[model samples]
Target: MSFAKWIGGALGWSFGGPIGAIIGLAIGSLIDGTAQQGGFLLGDGQTSRKQSRGTHNKRPNYGKQTQRSQTQSGDFEVSLLILASVVIKADGIQDQKELDFVRQQFVSMYGKERANHAFRLFKNISQQQIPTRKVCMQIKQMMDHSSRLQLVHFLFGIAKSDGIVVEVEVKQIYTICGYLGISSRDYESIKAMFYNSSDNAYKILEITKSASVDEIKKAYRKMAKKYHPDKVIHLGKEHQQGAEEKFRQVQKAYEQLQKERGF
Candidate 1:
């Protein structure tokens, strides 16, 4: 397999995780010659770079894109970075609120320091343009079924990072997901996970260490009914798999509580 395929597969497995991503791309420099130009990095404040022929609004540039192929590791990162930058800045101006949100994701994916590096690199890549459609097609070819789903989830997470979703960002992600062969149902599954994870964790397994065993049981029962993977099986095999994964998490959380309290 090529480096791009290896990295994509690794990243798809981790999904929004940085360590695995960095590890996957460890064969060479994460930042390539195409990515080493002057541009606003993740935390480098809002600034523009040199634009392509049609790209008027100036931003930074890691030089000009000589070639564009999502199959190339550099190109793939460039595409993702561009996608992320566009999503975060879709609201007219890129602000600290949005940057902070992306930063937090960086920390989650690669830890604070490495994620910082990723942030910088991503910012640089975003300022430049590669063949978007060609790269998207290449990405679709390499990213497998489950990996594509995870990509949609990452896109959703990025959109949801700032607590408000831009219509453009939403449409862009939807389009990209479509390009990757992700069904509407798959898109919805990821979107629901993003919106639901923040507030839904509590509802999934109601358990406070201080709460009595009765409360725990009640919460589990309610969650079991609500999150039963079987309930959404009609959605299709992909959805059933997703729901099953979620159900496993629910089961694990409940089991942990049971063990802690000796219930």
Candidate 2:
């Protein structure tokens, strides 16, 4: 597929806000003799003008009754690119292993052709200075809870790709988690997956060692439900592998607790 078609068709709510601006800048740098210069594809498959005219002013409606719009694959893809850049540069050095991990993961999830297109965009994105708070706040507003959790999981995966997740990378991710409105508990739960600790299982389950058997079971059930692969089914099968990995980690954590507790 053409780069324009791939980007134009893949995004939805992400085609607006801070995320959109980041993407716009990336596309501007990448667009050359091959692609159209005057317009690009919007999520709806329409040709947008030089700017995303109608969308720049649009804000996510916030309320108890207002529901977040579903996150499309393109939205998730672009978000991942931007955040991965943030984590990779957190230590002031871009490790090749981390960059390879990003490419490999995209290839596994999106196939070779699409992965190439994504990497091209990612290269451009990595060169720019991103506003982490504004980008993350837009994501928190536009994306659903499960999708946002999935994002955190992926960011941790990116940070850990280089064998060891550096302290700076961890700090960057923690800041992102806060900006994304992920609670400390949920952040710790996902963070536990990438590190080894004596109480990692408890942390993965969002519980403490002092908890009773009943609480262990309860936390397991809650975590299982929260990390279920089905939660991100709307993003298509490409994402199920990562979601399943998270779900399996939750199960393993619960099982470890079960073996230790002997109940």
Winning model by TM-score: 2
lDDT, candidate 1, 1-263, per-residue tens: 33332233323212222322332243244535314533211221111111111222222121333232112222233345655665665556666767777677556544575466667666554454433454445456544454345445556767776777778878877777776677775565455555544333343464444667888788778656655765643222333444465567567667766776798
TM-score of 2: 0.87
Clashing pairs in 2: none
lDDT of 2 by residue, 14-117 (tens): 77778888988988866763365433322223322212334434545433233467777667878989999999999999999999999999889977766876
C-alpha TM-score for every candidate: 0.47, 0.87
Using lDDT as the measure, the top candidate is: 2
**Residue 78 C-alpha lDDT in model 2:** 86
Off by over 4 Å in 2: 1-8, 33-67
lDDT of each: 0.49, 0.82
* Model 1 pairs in collision: 18-109, 37-62, 48-59, 48-60, 49-58, 49-59, 49-60
Model 2: per-residue Cα lDDT at residue 152: 92
